[model samples]
Target chain A: MNSTLLRTSALRSALRAAAPKTSSRAGLAGTTFVRSKVTLPDLPYDYGALEPAISGKIMELHHSKHHNTYVTSFNNFSEQMAEAKHKEDIQTQIALQPLINFHGGGHINHSLFWENLAPTSKGGGEPPKGQLAKAINDNYGSLDAFKEKFNAALAGIQGSGWAWLVQDTQTGGIQIKTYANQDPVVGQFRPILGIDAWEHAYYLQYENRKAEYFKAIWDVINWQAAEKRFK
Target chain B: MSAPTYTLPPLPYAYDALEPHISAQIMELHHNKHHQTYITNLNSALRSQAEAVHASDITTQVSLQQAIKFNAGGHINHSLFWQNLAPASSVDAKSSSAPELIKQIKATWGDEESFREAFKAALLGIQGSGWGWLVKVETGKEQRLAIVTTKDQDPIVGKGETPIFGVDMWEHAYYLQYLNGKASYVENIWNVINWKTAEERFKGTRADAFRIFKASI
Candidate 1:
């Protein structure tokens, strides 16, 4: 985990160093610069791997169509922002903020969500172990109790949103949080697990009986991935 | 001044009235739970906005813009939506009941079928949670009809424009029965549209069209 964190920060610093320091009309006239673009991450499992819990059709649409749209839109808006910034167009930049947040957060959330699932054959639904298990037991008495609380939060979400199990970076305690729309878990909270409550997540199979989807998702939850995040 | 509270308005027809087109379960949850939650949240946001106003807190007031817009728009849109629908068996469900509105629709799109096709296309074009509206736009003495869509609980509030009728394109509107078959939901909605209400809204003033919303406060 320490190595991974170190690598991420190192890459970020490298990118920052490569970025242009100043925007000038002469500098922009004919210069070519590298701009990083976010791309849709490949799912860890096949579309059909989750099986009876979630349909392959739904997974295909969710990943290819929905998640890809976010990635594409985020990149598009980022390009627009760069152009706006160069022109000193404050109003245009301000107007693009919400679109950037929505699509960028959607990309971040879905990327994490894909990593947090695995086929049942590949340790999906396996219970948490070691430190993660102890934390769950300490926080909510039992894993069953924790899941019940998580499911309740998932069910209570209005319209399109996600429910997350997050760890406080400061206190190192876990809590369930709900975000409206594509709002991501940020600030002091580190997202350990997230379940999308958007209709597109389960409407193909569960329809309006979202409680069924919420309950059934447990069968395919990649707890090992969650446990890693918990650490 | 105190913030005005809003309440959920009852559906104009029974839950099962839409029948095989839309399920009773969908209607019950959509109306009782989904619509009710919006009103509850709207009232809460209004109260918060009122406190912010009293305290002269511009920052808090700005922060509450989204909550107020989402919840209030939800309340207003759903209020109009309930009145916009009728049981398929009712006389109001027939387009002929709205002769003037039908005439306008025909005039706008060459024929009623063409108009419906355009509306259906607009409904399906929406990528996420939203509403599809057929609105009346009046520019001086010239009145025109147009189809428009609003994203995420935004209401039709343009000056000189009034919603003739709107179809809820949100997933909750048909996902229970239609699931991902959004095209079918859009196709079937025309069957339950209350043309009687459409005619009244077409002929009446904006205040008259929004009277149901006023009654909810």
Candidate 2:
């Protein structure tokens, strides 16, 4: 069979296996094109909560405009893919890769970005506890050692990318990685902490001196959210 | 308006702040020349991409992919890299440390040395373009620290892991000083390791973990 037919069949099978949340069998049918819905995620805190570290304007634009564009594109891609599959079209599916990459990436990156931040008023300053703390000390000699290493790596990325604390799916251990553009973290690693380095992420507040802005962002990190995600 | 000219990010500390481990010359070049290139390229790409999209009347906006990835990644990566560094004098491991952070590391890895050895080994083992990390994992029962490696610009904390420490192994990270022998670079990078920030992260990780556990159960 053609690649389109194969992808369509695979997608159908996968959707079928999803245990359709909706009762209508129409939801499972391969005939009609049904667009998947993608909604804008609400920021957990008020727009100005991360002020000083992250300005309200940046947050407003990053979330409302930048992230919204991703959501819309993602939904469009899903609908188009669904339609292409129904029509037994493989070339179209392949062409949609960039759309999925850009929009899907935007959605995933921003979602993490929002959760990673919290108002400094909250216990955002609270540190790691128990086994997590133990591991940090043991590995780097001291927490300071880890920070130095982490920061050095963070500063090393060539351009617009993200610094992350991730879990290796293979070993179930945490690792740090950086991805450029909207590159998604593939496979087993799960992100626990992330720092956005895109210029827009800091420019207005720190100007060309990106380091100043980076230094400040840590003050508002949502450790509480990170802890929950880690668990 | 003409495109903004990108300059090298000025080092927060003197070239010798890191001293014996990372030389002043190395620091100067790394920050001033290398990082500056990334910024310049990122801005250049964005502008050209914007122009291309406008000229072609291609609403699909596909050509901007490379520009965004290359330039944007460069910008974000370097920004984090700058913040990650600090003077070694600022850290005090035994007494000045955050209690919870020290306690957690001791619980998981026995002692700081053991943890260092493991983390260092992970860093030393990178085969190609990649990084090594020490991170905290929040298990249902407790938060734990584990070490792992990754390829290219892959951020250690993407899908869900909290990154505590990372070691860069890319050629640009060490090539000027260590040349083709990455092992030497890996060994040397450790001299400038920052312990203070790692401690702060530990404090935050522990507190966060406890709160989550209590709330979940």
The DockQ leader among the candidates is 1
DockQ of 2: 0.03
lDDT of each: 0.83, 0.63
Model 2: CA > 4 A from native? A1-35, B1-217
RMSD of 1: 8.1
Question: What does candidate 2's lDDT look like per residue over B54-137, in tens digits?
Answer: 677464347656555654444444544554556556553222444665577778889867877777777764433556766777
| Best candidate (score: TM-score) | 1
User: Model 1, B1-217: lDDT tens per residue?
Assistant: 4999888888878999889778898888889987888899889988999999999999999998988888888888888988999988899999999999999898889999999999999987665689999999988998999999988799988888889899998888886677566789999998899999999999987788888877878
User: What are the per-model DockQ values?
Assistant: 0.20, 0.03
* Candidate 2 lDDT by residue in tens digits, A173-214: 776788775665656777778887765566545545666776
- Kindly give the number of clashing pairs for every candidate: 0, 74
